[model samples]
Target: MSILPVSSIYLIIDLISGFFELLEYTFYRRAMITGFLASIVFGIVGTYVVIKRIVFISDGIAHASFGGIGLAFFLSHYLVFSFDPLAGAAVFALISAVGIGLMSKKKVQREDTAIGIIWVLGMALGALFFTLTPGYQTSMENVLFGNIYMISDVDIYLLSILVVFVLVAVFLFYHELQAVSFDEEFAEVAGVKTTFFYLFLLVIVALSIVFLLRFVGIILVIALFTMPASIASGLSHDIKKIMLYSWILSLIFVMGGLFLSYVFDFPSGPTITLFGGIIFIAYTLARWVRV
Candidate 1:
């Protein structure tokens, strides 16, 4: 009443109500719901990824999944076999994850070299297969950049199942995985199955990449995975606490994405990714300055 003008207060209230009204749309609601769900995975897995310094591993798996998509399409169209691209993507992702883990564990090649080779090979295979497929491949556009509004009920169902799976799996092996993530050599010396947990962790990463493909595209998904945990790590040293903080931070980052997109007439994926990048960068700079 004193400092704020009456007109300004009404305008603010109008904007708030209008924004909530936008959520009434089915697509916007789904976008927000899936975004929130993805944040949970992002927080837990992202914490482990940052702790273990395996940020780019998910990138490779995500890219590699393209090959599976093409293969699934080819099989479905040419052989008339029923196949889901997402399932194919999950399969390819698991293969890539396991391959990377084994190669690094066995000292067969530099980890980055292995990842790069797999990444390109997957994309190349995807392109080749798509070219061979008969019709104009319109669906692939959604796969490349993501279209949250175009996400289906089936996608949400699958995402929900994967979230539950990830939670239960993490809960059962939290301590063992935590130890492996924080210090593999020490954990191995301490009688933990470092190799098993390491591979298991990568498997989780692979699954996450596949499920999150719709909400965030392949190119931008890594930032969401890497940044939330990195930010939480700076705030807290305790792993569990870091995950909790990261989850909350991820929730916040996703909150305004849809509204910004609606307002600015932009793609939902880039809006979300850019929003996250700004927050991540701000936190980094602030932390650096404080130091």
Candidate 2:
């Protein structure tokens, strides 16, 4: 007695048919391209995030971007200025990143406390803005849960530019970033301008979060950002190796999750995150057994 729904069986058949005739489906192609670009950015920046142990702050920035998205929607009708939610998320993410970075100083405030405040405040503001927007029906499901099928040619172009810029910038500054991630005091002692580099890293994180919003949404972006790198970190201590592994793992998770979503009609973002979590759990179990 199988409990599989008839739709599920039909989906499996459709998936097989679609595999060979991939070009027939524009949505699938767009998702693949977007996922690939997202994996690359996450691989590069997430390694640094894991090494620096600022995953919490990264999560904060991701959530805080919601405030920007809500604000964009609220202002678009009334304001003379053009309002792009993605741009709004970018601006809000950067502000949150900079705020977290500056407030992280021991003399100023507890970093975790600041992150908690930003995280909660961001959601609260978003709720308030949504409430105030007149006659605008809520469609925040896409922002909150993500729908990679919604990605457009413009998004692809923007992602392409962002990926190139991140790769080149990080490549040029690899050594400095490496020093700062492993040991900030030592980097400062070596005249690495730790504050400047730290700020630069946070800004990159902000950009990455904004770029990933459509692909994974704000709710699951943190998982995509951290899980692949986390798995990589478990396998290697070297930053380069970790990044490479993260990219490969992320590709697997995203591609497999997309296929599963297409077949079973599940949300792509959570499916992807779920796959990553499963892998992480297996790795952890393996390590524990080894010990």
Candidate 3:
């Protein structure tokens, strides 16, 4: 690996100072914290997602969140009840995750076929609901591409709880999770509850998608979820080490991308995801050359 020169050291100092100044603002602070929590959850969940080769299922759930967003906004108009779009997304994500999880097991249909149908249905439902929504106009940009500035105190709290939940779940069930990830039939024959574990894993994935919504939006959450894990998988065969490396890689991408967006006035979600993709490509190239 190459090292930075003295000039680069000064640049790093200046950048850190600027980032600290930005953190003085409440929204900036929340964005950074939220990004940090998101990194942790995504890293842990993403390891199983990558190793299980269920990236498509994750993608479907993320995209399906749009339906929940639209449903929340539409219901808020006439239902005399308050609805949080994020909550709606959580609900829809769980439904989609479970639905797809079960459907993929059916011998009657191909998994991709089921995923594609649900994917399009979710998008269409969202569009219909958003179009019919009255009075206030929704910002498609914010819906499709997230703005870290939109993160709130409630989001912070929810994400904090989620990170803790994920940590505990993974720690307690690490062996079972590992068993299922590598081979479901072997795990089943060994008396593991394969079906329950499979659905439970998908539920965790749903929550991860919801937690990432404010930071990356539904459109780009999958990128942040999968890319870091992809890079980590290339680097480590041990699941625990892969999770740790993925967390570190995700943090670097989230923080560096946030800084880059702040400096260049780019959309934070896509900018962060783009940075992750670039880093993965670079890492892969370096590994190939070394080999």
The model with the greatest TM-score is: 3
Winning candidate number (lDDT):
3
Off by over 4 Å in 1: 1-15, 134-137
How well does each candidate superpose onto the true structure, as a TM-score? 0.92, 0.92, 0.93
List the RMSD of every prediction in angstroms: 2.8, 3.1, 3.4
Q: Count clashing pairs, candidate 2.
A: 0
Scored by lDDT, model 1 comes in at 0.86
TM-score of candidate 1 to 2 decimals? 0.92
The Cα error of candidate 3 at residue 215, in Å, is: 0.7
In order, what lDDT does every prediction score?
A: 0.86, 0.86, 0.87
lDDT of 2 by residue, 22-140 (tens): 64788778888999999998888888888888899999998998999889988986788869889889989999999999889544878888999999899888777877877644347
Candidate 2: stretches off by over 4 Å: 1-14, 19-23, 134-138
TM for candidate 2 is 0.92
The 10-residue segment of model 3 with minimum total lDDT is 134-143
| Whole-model lDDT, model 2 | 0.86
